[model samples]
Target: MMLNDIAMIAIVGAMTGVTTVLFGFGGGFVVVPFVYQLFLRQPAIANNALHIAVATSSAVMIVNAGWATFQHQRRGNVTADILFPLTLFIGLGAVMGSLLAGQLNEGTIRLLFILYMLVTIVDCLVSRRFLKGCEARPLSMSTTTVGGVAMGAVAALLGVGGSVMTVPLLRRHGFSMKHCISHANPLSLPVALCATITYTFDGWGKIPDSGFIGYISLTTLVTLVVAGGIGITISQRYFPKIPDWWHARLYVLLLIAVLIAMLW
Candidate 1:
């Protein structure tokens, strides 16, 4: 790699590290936008690169989520009973999502991404109502399966980890935020791994001269992983002190910003 490449890696690493510490899961959001901007300057890497970028981001998430789960589990917050079945279905869903993404058009994919983010913003805003109802009752297998399927579909469509959806669903099902995050941390591993593998294999024929293995971008992947590792360490230590309302407002603003950028 050239010096410029090394410099880019350093920058991405630092950004990912900071995001991991602050949000515990903003690597993709950070890397994707930053990379998209970088590719705009080098348009040769732009075409079909988004797919590779998303795949690499997911692959990095597998490692990031594993480390995060360990940290959360050490705190005695992860719930195995809920995570097992949910993970199984989420993995399956991720595979299907990757396949679908391979077949979808770029415009369609972009629109879907925006729509999914909007839905997440809506969920964050109404989370209290949903959680109140969930606290009054437990989610049945059918409900859980349905939720898992929807999350998987959206994740595949947008190349997100599905945790934003998963966390909210868990909370609505009466699980506390801490427990939900703990279990979801491990659960995201399968989602990212499955999706990454599928996307990598499925998009191989499409990506060219992109330093990719399937849809995985080595450049972005390396930077994101390094940065995400740092972020995970911080979130694990300070996450508990952060309020849920603040997180919701942040999500709302992020969604709005993404919407405007995509539309413009």
Candidate 2:
């Protein structure tokens, strides 16, 4: 990579780190669209540009999630009772999804990603109602597996870091917001790690400028990891003190930015 590439990665990393800290979601929901636009402006990458973007985002998330999970665990949020079994299917599903991503068209993937983001926005707006009926029931092994599989598929397809769905699902199922975020952070690590590994295999021998294993650029990954780690640590410390209305507004702003990126 050139000096310009290093600069770009650092800039992207700082931005991504801030977003992950504030939102508890990986930056890919923002990063992939931005990367797509960047590629459009420069045209250095090939037609499969978004795939590389998605893969790279997932790769970064693995590191970010690991850091966040550790802190969350220390706060008594992560429970093996909830996390262990889910890993089984989430791992497999992410691999399958990454393998499939290679054969899909960029336009189709982009549109689907946009649509999903819109739905997520709507869900965020209506989250209080959606999260109202939390009941902490003991999850059967089957139900947990199904949920994990579904989450893994979506995470691989969009490189979304897994917290958006995981948080709400956990909340609706009776987990507190703090606990939900904690569990979700660790859960995301497995999904991101699996997807990154699978995407590496699928893109092997073809992906460009991606440094370490496959489609993720090493410089980009390291930069984001550092920024995201700091962001998550700080955010977790201060998040609970933020007011609810402000939090709502933040989510709205995120949705608007994501929508604009998708449309652009």
Candidate 3:
């Protein structure tokens, strides 16, 4: 890659890393759209640009999630009781979601992502009562399992780290924002791995390039992982000081930005 491309990748990686930790999501919300636009500029990959973008974003999350999880674990924020079961169900769902994504057209995927963002905004705005109740009583096992599956599926389909869904759900279930983020960080690992593997084989022969394996770009992955690691480490040190109310607002604002980026 040229110096300009390297520079762009580094910038995106830095942003992804910070957001991944900040929101406890895989950063796919940021990475996929940007990569999609970048791919669009290259006529060679335009035909499968969305697929490549999504898959590559998922692949990058493997590293992003690992780094974030390590940071959270170090802070004693992760709850193993919640993490393991959710990871299992989410991984299964991620496989299914990746397969489903392969069958859909680009326009449909984009539409789904837009709708997902809109629904998230509405949920955040109207679910305060439900959240309070959840805080009082944790969700049942069956409910958490079902929710994990659904979250994993949607996240894999959209190339996100499943945090967008997990964080809010956990918050509603009464998990502190820190706990929600901590749990959400590790869950991305299974989802990313399953989705990445599925996408790799699904697009094996379809995408032919030395730097690419199926739809993933190794150069981008490496760059993002390194920069993301730095971002996560820095953010974790300061995130605890941010007030809870501000976290909600920041999450909402981030979603809004993602919405605009999608529509743009």
Q: Where does candidate 3 have its weakest 10-residue lDDT segment?
A: 129-138
Candidate 3 lDDT: 0.82
Question: Which candidate leads in TM-score?
Answer: 3
Candidate 2: residue 105 lDDT (0-100):
82
- The lDDT-based order of candidates, best leading, equals 3, 2, 1
Give the TM-score (vs. native) of candidate 1: 0.84
TM-score of 2: 0.84
The candidate, 1 or 2, that scores higher on lDDT is 2
lDDT of 3 by residue, 194-222 (tens): 88998899888786556888888888788
- Models ranked on TM-score: 3, 2, 1
Model 1 alpha-carbon miss at residue 250, Å: 3.9
Clashing pairs in 1: 16-227, 17-227, 20-231, 21-231, 200-215
* TM-score per model over all chains: 0.84, 0.84, 0.93
Candidate 2: tens digits of C-alpha lDDT, residues 1-264: 557766776666666665665556666776687666655454555576787778888888877777766766777767898887887777767776777777888888888788877887777667773334345766677668887788788878888867777766665567655566567667777778877887788777765544545666566677767766666666656656544345445645776787887787
Best by lDDT: 3
What is the C-alpha lDDT profile of model 1 across 1-264, one tens digit per residue? 367765775677665555443344535555555555555456555666567656776887777777777777777877667876777777777778878888876667767777777777777667675434345355578756776776776675566677667767776777655565567667677778878888877877666565778777786677667766765666555656646546445544655665565555
